[model samples]
Target: MLRLFSVLIAAGLFLACLTGYVLENYTVQQRTYGGAGEHLRGAQPPYPAGGMDNIFWFLQVSDIHISRFVDPQRAPDFQKFCTETIDVIKPEIVLVTGDLTDAKERNRIGSRQYEIEWQTYQTILKKSKVLEKTKWIDIKGNHDTFNIPSLESVNNYYSSAIAHLCGHLHTLGGFMPVLHSRHERGTLELELADWMDNRRYRVLVFDHDLFSFVDLKFDKWPVVVITNPKSALYSSPAHEPLGKIKHSTHIRVLAFSPAQVTSVLIKIDGVTMGSAVHIKGPLHTLPWRAKDYSTGMHYIEVRAQDKAGRTTIIGHKFTMEEVRLLPFDIMASFILRSSHYMTLRVIFILVLLANILVIIAFRYLTRPQLKESPGFFALVNFSFHVFSKTNILYYPVLLFTCYIAVGPWFIGEIVDGHFGACFVFGVVVDGHFLEGSLTFLIGILQLTFFNIPLICYLCWCLLLRCRGAYFRSHIKYTGWSCSVPMHISMLGLLGWQVYACYLLQKTYGTAAFFLSPVRTWSVILALVLVYKAWNLNNSAIRTFKADMKNCPYS
Candidate 1:
């Protein structure tokens, strides 16, 4: 029985080691969620039960520099950590807030360098469209706006568009939604409709120049349409691909001077919509067909007339969109020690071998001397079996360490909006969780990886039994058939190192070079041996107690 126990112990230790190695080192697949190059994120469960708040609003971002030129003091900001925060959380809406690029600084005049910056932004947006379905909108951004010779050549020419919107022979004051601010101060969208009952519903367009204080749109929810809350308006033009555009759709209403000899009129090619009085303070609603207007690749012209009937027609056209998404490799910015992964397998095998040698040497040395005790064989067998010293205080530390090592793998699910994973993490690793905070790395080496095995080995030593002088060294073990046994979940969890390797390969690809099968099994081997040692000590102690009671020692 004692010899059989020894065999079982050795087998268990070897099997555990093998399981860890095989799992850790395999290669697998490339993981890219939501198509974004950088999807890495800390965990966050699902949205709270309630719907989003009305006061909340997200930014409309188009072009912001993140490369070698990021500046904090200047216009473009480099500390884009907030941007990442927004991306993972999935805000309400992000309209296209334009001009993410400049002339690239080398063009001498910023007018010619659109090719590099323009395309990159578009691709990023397309990939990051992981927000809730109804939230994403792409308004025309200035950087993406058409490059033309004059204001008339631009698609959203501000001044002339407003003049034609009023239905008068001449008009003044209204602007289209254009480049917004780098930091959206309040609600991203604003409405000024109630105060402008008499005026047309005008949506003020803001871009680089339009941001300012005292603007009525300030502090208001973006749903508000009119810019000048007190005035009603219209603007530039709302164009269609096939029909003539009415420079009448997008605009902001400025100061209203009623009865001031109105002359502005809106027309679609040949038909005139109507005429307005220069003194009309507000027009009430936007052009009848404003919402259906065409955008990029489309064109329109609005004719504006001053109070004296001095008229000029301004035209704006946008070419069809031809840009495509950027390639995914752009995220290589975070890569370190890139490789084909050649030496990983060899190193792991050698480590496993060394560990086995150490285990053998430990068993041979420092064992207690034998004594002429009748129950020695029975004690050895009983002590080496089940439920032994493995439960020593050190195990709490090891369990804590394993929790840390395996816990970070689930952070992705949390960030992507799964509440369940959060609870699971809390239950498994205690509230603080391992690898969650940054400083965990400093504390990890001192963690359980080494100590857990050491504890198990120590317990196994206590399980050995000896008899006569010739058998001076104690060595024997046993197993008990009837026992409640520890929870299987604990054993399964101990084997998690194997699963972790498979998981790594599954995420990064079977060819990924970071982990090796052997490394994973090494952990398993180490833990299993610990468990067996504890089992041996418990079995031997119980049988020794029973045998001595039965024998006539008196």
Candidate 2:
């Protein structure tokens, strides 16, 4: 029974090592700009239980252009939108892409005008009480910054208000802060709405100035209109392609302005699908369906107008596909796009190897009388125990580590306004592709310098278990088989993980990286391991002393 137990330990460790390696490699190789890249083309799942049939709706509003130069009625206009118009639509979430405020004038740098504009923006939201009803996220635009020439006229505007934009965002609720590395840039993730199954969609948002106005439409308050049919990427004047949808697929559209916007109109191939039902809510989706239309290239267009008679129009050609209800495909699309076909085969082989190791360790091998005769298998058996059951916190620590390794993807889901699905993992490891891979490099450095060394040190402790007699004559060794050094090493790893969490917090402008449910538990797990190790080591020392008193040699 003792031998069988040892074999099981060995098998478990071997399996864990293999699993860890496979997951790490898959995550690294599949990292993409937004996530899963082009694999998102057809990964939409079915709607949730309460999802609207044949229609998915979301609101898009952009370029409020809140400026100090605007008339006094501007504040009231924003208020009416949030309290009256937006409250009526009641969308699932609202996307305020960029240009929340206009700061093109260089003279406004030190005039306190910039502060007032932001104050109005905040006050409007507060008075409207819309944030609680809907998820509203705003990014940065060129006009929101100081003296951005390309978007504005190229003039020598002596302004020092470059950093003020982020300050306003920090004060406003729902917007993510600007991230700084060598330069300040704004970033957010947008997950495409999925159909009923597990289709994953994510888009990365950057806060920076554009080189030309040609990209403004898509870059502004962007809207993705998913059509049922798949067709060539048609160049729309303003909007970009969201994804491919089936006949019954749900689509979300964000309206740029609620106050200036009188009503949002949706159409399929020149026929009105539905006028988005407006309500007294912060966010609402205009649900529409396409049952009468046959499968072919169909045009999906949305237009929103304000009280001033200004209108924004965007349309795209969509190819409708035959609907087939299947299981989740977003994750499967990622796996298929990752091109790691060997994962299943490798897992199978690893399982078989583990079983063989168990049989050999328990059914055949025994602790040999001679030290050298026991050889590498004995060392492996001992090493397995080092990872499997050295400290009382072994399982807890291991589990915690695994959770953080994959927690970022789920967090991404929250940012993208989706729940009950995790399309990707390893947020820190994958990093933002546009950010010059800074976060990615940090992840690699942590693994190489911290995790690898910690594992090596733990494995080295197996040597201590080889046999006291083998080293007894060399230096008059003591029979103290305690895990003091191993305990210290684990403590070091725990300390380093805490530091890593801080690094992420500094970069992201929020402690959310470490404070996440997965990472918070990691800290507690490490603390428990530290305490347990100290107690076990003390007990081992006491037991060793008692054995010495009864020794024949004594």
Candidate 3:
């Protein structure tokens, strides 16, 4: 128990340190969401003083997660921009958007976040020179005002502070109303002014999901006009009827790859009421470190208000697309033109070579002699040597490994880490379960070389039992010959893993499969393994019968 506690403490400290390093080292860049169309000087409205109508540049930044995972650079960039904008432009009013902290903000008191985010906010305020100066205010962004303290609660909590800062609260408070007004019955429900108009121009803060919606403003209470480009978030049928939508049946996108042009179909129980839109370009890929990213909900209901003041709701779903990726040479020559295909190919070759080297090493080093001993014991010993001698000091090392390295890696955070290794694991596991025989030939060389050996070793260890004594005997042939039941159990596990991987590949596409074909092929190869197992089981039974014959039919 003491050893276990020590390990837990050590792991916690390691993770905390890692997270801290990321937060401290990185730099932030100034990013803007609103006030893109026009620019104006600060603390000065587009119009003169004492005018009931006013216009000023405003920025809305939500989900501003300031945590270990958040790029540290973003925080400082925000501070610099705020400082420069405050010192130079000095707008009449400023609204600091919500979601200031990246930490797990279940509680504001004991959670270490108060000091971090509070200080960060204080810096922004000091640098902006707005805290003691202009009409600066804030409202709840998703991160800050979400479930933890509730948007309403946080708004109320910060109300006094914001009121002391500036009069911009009146403008931001109506931002959500402007955003929702486009929806059916989305008329500006706020009993407040929705637009800022002077002799020069008009500015509006619309607060709907920007990707799928339009932006507009005019000199009317409920009557407004949209004059921006089409929003990326909405899903329109490929076959639009004229310029208008005739029958807006719901469409669902099962899968979509913006670059690669791939997608799958989805089946909603009833009529599909929404179409999923996934668009990936150069920007989202850079900072997010995404090869091919995807995010969509199972359900999104559509609704709108008519000219007669009645509201109608509709449902929709549509086909999904898989962003396509190919060798850059192929694309450049035959498709879009050169964009670093050769570089990727070179890297790919290097990785393949590395996997081959590792596989050759593992098969020779770990393969045990074929005798009456367990195979899993050999694997355990091998892993112990590779990872460290820590396992020798404590048995919990194995459990901890499975939990940390395997369990969490498998169940959570599928999007992070060395993706190629994971892809190979998926390929081999999937092939054995679902595809069938001969799929082994399709296994990526890397998966076969690297991942298969690991699967074989893990299976062997899991089946042979947790105790070291269960596998005492070793031989020059099999290395460690596990008993018949143990061997069968290991084989079965490998088969299941293969099946699960194959399914993931089929459903998600072969981004990972191509990365590690060997593992993918092993999964396909699992089918052939069943016959091998049956033959071995029969051999074991036959050998037992022969021994019994000499023992006198008892």
Candidate 4:
């Protein structure tokens, strides 16, 4: 009945996994929409006839990392930008990508959500009054997700946004704009430089259906965003409709500078299209026939130079048709985005399968036997002769096996300020189970390689003794041969524990010593076990001939 039950459960799990795999593959192929660079030829354009007239601008900031405990000045600096720079730009919207607060403790080893940091972030927004001036959108970064059980948890202090924006990498010196492909089907991914150090932000302008942006430093001038001929790199008709550039009559540019604007020049395909005339504040226009270059993709360059000799040149590919990401880019994006969940899934499946295999092997080994078998069984019977109940080594071996099965292998702060115990079952963080922990993986390994084998060896010995098998005459000759493998497995497990301790010390600092006392003890235990196993294996081989001399056949 037990075997049938195990077989049924295994079959069900396999079928469920196969079904999910098939469905997932089918869904992915259908969602790809004919793979990379394929466009819907007859799709309606995003912008109407007068694309330049429908323009709006927004401000984007990322990786604020506001930490009152670490960098107290960052909060005030961000506030200053909100008040001074934001007032000048007067953007229609403000998008904060992520990393609103630094979740690190003073030691920088542990992580937890600090209410004070979140309150500081909130106070800055309210004090700046920037929230009232524009639509503010903020999302959680990887830092925000640390130690958070879920998004709905009270510990999660992030303001909700339409989409999630990542700011964990602090990539490109936080000065350049990047589009991550992992965002949901119509979502746009924009990563901004950190407000903690660089004081960088982006001014993104959308004119008609064309999107143009400029990365700006705090108080820096000559902010330029091309208002016409949208960059082809950002073209996504599935998400946002694009304008038909064939109907455009003039090139439009928005350039802002504290000093006098000297020249705003336009270029198409590297050829000069003449200087643009300043029509209004930050608005420059140059007449061009968009129909001439409408058939193929063309490069548009806008150079804005001020009286202060500050030259800012921006270039982008513009085309009338839609553009799609390459297949490799799409696959990479999917892998990166799903990496966390994928790891959890893979580990869970591997552990599950390992346990199932252990159960099957245990059942097969302990099956009822009419007569003693040869090879491995003969070795087991011979080894059990030394492991009889009366032997002095038997009690020590049994006691050690039981201790390892139930003992607390290590104790540490599983999450900031929360001390917990690790057992064979799993790691208990505070009072709750720490899901998807690597410590738990180690426990499973110990059970498979060390505890189970030792327990089986002890049980086999008792079984032979119950059958009235006599081994006292050969006890002095046959040493603990089976015990060697058991000790070696324990040594390996202890070695793994030591490596884990080293990693903890490297990552967390001196605090690891105080937090995990078992790490130090494990090293001592491993050395002792290695010495005992070596002595026992050597004694067993030396006594083998003596045991054969006492046999009835000899």
lDDT of each: 0.31, 0.41, 0.32, 0.61
lDDT by residue for model 3 (435-489), tens:
2222222233324433444434443332222222123331222343435555666
For model 2, the stretches where C-alpha displacement exceeds 4 angstroms are 1-329, 332-365, 368-378, 382-459, 462-491, 494-554
For 78-100, candidate 4 gives per-residue lDDT tens digits of 89888877776788888888888
Question: 95 in model 3: Cα distance from truth in Å?
Answer: 5.1
Q: Residue-pair clashes per candidate, as listed?
A: 73, 43, 81, 3
Per-residue lDDT tens digits for candidate 2, residues 1-554, read 79679979998998899678545433323121221112233335442111323333445554565666745554576576567545545655666555566653343322112666777778887888889988766666544544332234333222222222222222113222211111001121122221111111122221011000101222122222222222223211112222223323333443444354466677778987665544322122455454444454577777766566667676765543332111222332233333243443344334334433433343244432224334555554544444444444344545434443444422322221222222122232223321222333333444445534544444443233222222223123323343455556667777777765654344332435644443344556545543443334534334322323322221
Error of model 1, residue 96, in angstroms: 7.0
TM-scores vs. true structure, each candidate: 0.23, 0.28, 0.25, 0.59
Tens-digit lDDT string for candidate 1 (293-404): 3322333333444344344443333221221111112112111112212223333334434444333444444433333453545444333332232244234433444543
Residue 263's C-alpha lDDT in candidate 3?
21
Give the winner by lDDT: 1 or 3.
Answer: 3
- The best-first sequence of candidates by lDDT reads 4, 2, 3, 1
Most accurate candidate by TM-score? 4
